[model samples]
Target: MNLKGVRTGIAAACAVVSLGAASSAAAQGQCSRDTLDDIAAKYVEGQKQGSIFTLPVGEWVDYRENGQLVSTATGVISQPSDFDWHLALVDTGTCHVLVHGVILKPVPYVVTTQLAWTFNGLGQIRSTVVREGDANFDAKKTYAYASKEDWSEIPAGKRDTRQALLALANAYLDRAGGGAADVALAPSCDRIDNGAYSTNCEPAPGAAFVDREFTVDEAKGAVAVVSNRGEAEGPQDSRIFRIEDGKIRHVHAVTPSQ
Candidate 1:
């Protein structure tokens, strides 16, 4: 299932709310990049230890100064889609929040099973938005909780990071081949062939061309797929994919410019 689109819509809503709100107090000092780095390091360690993998409830202090609301973080994670991670962050000082992440499942339904943070206290998350495979989303209806039994039933192969990467690539290829518009391909698929663009092929006036290459590093469990095509004119460039999934499902892509 593709959830990136839905996650993106929610992230955008969080941004609007964060920007509209006023900060409760000014930040005494800016958070150092090193501080963020340390926090990330610990976060990774916690994940590895399986100690901090569960989501938090109510309010929590992600960053603190004497525990006085220096900053707060709230977020949600989704599963079974293109977005491996979707996150939004709000700087309480300026009430500014930014959203970023990767999409893993991109077709039939986009799924963004990642994390997003909001700090301005204006950002709120409704995890029960809808069930994992529900085609329609009704705001008035409450979401049914996903039981542990349901989660355990998901096949391990479906949760494999490498498989997820390939699935995402194939989905993008399908979209490109289908003449779908506005769909972004991975940057790894972007390459030029003798002044000819590749990947993201669309039906041309006289000819239909689609061609590309992919490289998957098993050691690193990283996959890079590039698509390119040549027509009567020259060539067209496309996208790339950068995936990180080990045990639990996590996949993302970096655009050509990124």
Candidate 2:
């Protein structure tokens, strides 16, 4: 998996390339969160059928697998696979959704995908990063843990601000890279990478990260950060966070096994 698309979502995604996720997201206020969820669900179904044409990839599409440009007509999405389960993050502010799936049939694989959509009735899939036997990866365990995780929507009044959420995300990355961050962690914070898991993590500054693009779901104190998108092959890296009361509750990731 090319972690380069890690930065791709925030930096060079389809429509967000020119306008940036922040600017364009405001202008595309008409983008429907429910629609995004529906599209993502469709993508999950499409993958099982080995058909990329199932989704509304409008006009011109820019598809990539592990940072290497791919001919959308014949790429990973065209290959049918069985997934144990999948997790989807809908970022209405950025008009992009991050889809993370774990496959357990034939050979096991974990895939992280990001899709860019516009109100013009066009949905463009910009990145599809696949990981096979990455570090600490155990597809079955991941599926089991994911099923128990609570990602329910945070009540509107109880939600953390986007800026706060973003900071927490950066902090997690910082700590991951061995830096000192001043973010809070819940008493029972959980961290999952591939299938290996940990608990009660500390926070740090995310400056160790570069070329980062963030997909934030303010409604749920969740953020998915994809960094180093410019690299074709590095680490298939991604960090997802859920924070409440300024303390991180969960951290999720997909990276190289070796």
Candidate 3:
């Protein structure tokens, strides 16, 4: 699809995301990180094996890719891919995990997916990937920066609560989307997309962010930031963040070229 076509799709994909989590997930009770981590492993295995059934999913798992709601059976997860490597952001509070992987086969693709393990079962998955034609997409470069970055658990003393993490992330989107959002950045913070890297870390010149979704991992002080909609310019969608001691540290994003 062309760029405009991609933008149109994101506009439609915005309605159903529910900002990336189930409304009653907390009431339903959170799953242990270990359990969520296991489900994440199965998700990667599903990609490696190309079988959606590999997930212990609920009766109906809502799967949305690139802002379009599609069948899980025909989704990327069902497509067999040989990956160079994969990294996962596990969030226990909301029972969500965002998996970022670089696939080697079927024409290189950088896939960033967020799957929610709900009380009903493994439910809700949203994905945005940068393939060969995507703007600034260089799988090798993407892997180089993304893989080298550290997303390991934050020390207990330095960890921020889930609520704080969410606020910080939205603040980023505020600045990213062209609004005046007071966000902090560590001296080390860098925004990375596919294979491109930049220390400037600015979003589209005037493009706004909407249809946002977040997968916050308190343990690691990172959140998977998804601006489900696309922008006319600059990068938008699936910008993951790593925060430490009230500062933005690292960011990895998936979007069409700016």
Candidate 4:
């Protein structure tokens, strides 16, 4: 479940080494929000088939599971199952989409997975990073959060600019890691790890050091952060924030690093 970084495993490590030298200009095609949504939907369907071959993808699509690169051929797509996509954040500007969902397979156990899908302008999948949790997870708690209506798109007037959204996410990370953060957390800010209820949005520092990664989706007031702990590496975590009256009203996370 905690497989570490893409630079860890043998096979995945090799891909990382070579892909670093791969030119980005070749895949820098522009993409639209609708296109990203369609791609995400296709991914959900592919998960059920246990093979993502149906989707438009490059010859060598970079794939990572739990930060570590797995067998591109038979790793995640090998398991066919029913997928329930709970929350989706589309960052058209970045040509990326982050989806929080659960993979339910009758054979073994249900798993909670957060998928970060990146696409080239040509609408083909360029990279996919999945953070999968344990097999056994709480369904009730997950449904409660996933069923909430607050996750919908924030109204334009209430929406924070991309910069502000990024700052809030950064501040929350700082506060969680014992750093002096000027952040505002909702009164009922709730956090979830895997599929279990974790905390009620408290300003408590966590054990590991958190490095603010990229803002995966500032439009929906959501951002993704990674922990930089020694060689083991930290989890690829994402959080969704609900803003009201210019203050953070609620917070939700999937595999929150803290």
Index of the highest-lDDT prediction: 3
Per-residue CA lDDT of candidate 2, range 114-224, in tens?
Answer: 777664323445453545545577878887887688887898999999888988787667666667766688998998778777884664323355557777888777888
Instruction: Judging by TM-score against the true structure, name the best candidate.
Output: 3
Ranking by lDDT: 3, 2, 4, 1
Query: CA lDDT of each candidate?
Result: 0.29, 0.67, 0.72, 0.52
> Under the 3 Å rule for N, CA and C atoms, how many clashes does model 4 have?
6
Model 3, 1-258: lDDT tens per residue? 111111111222232332233334435466778767877888888898977655655545567677676665677776888678787878766677888889867768898888867665555677887787888888888777777888888889889988888898888777776788888889867987677899866555445677676788888888887664445332447878888898888887788553
Q: Count of backbone clashes for each model? A: 38, 9, 3, 6
lDDT of 1: 0.29
Give lDDT tens digits, candidate 4, residues 7-92.
22224444443343222433645555776677567666767787755444433454555455666456665578665445666676
Could you give the candidate ranking by TM-score, starting with the highest? 3, 2, 4, 1
Per-residue alpha-carbon lDDT of candidate 1 for residues 155-225, written as tens digits (9 for 90 to 100): 44433454555565555555545545343333433332112333433322322324543433332333333
Candidate 3 TM-score, true structure as reference? 0.81
Clashing pairs in 3: 135-257, 142-194, 142-195
lDDT winner between candidates 2 and 3: 3
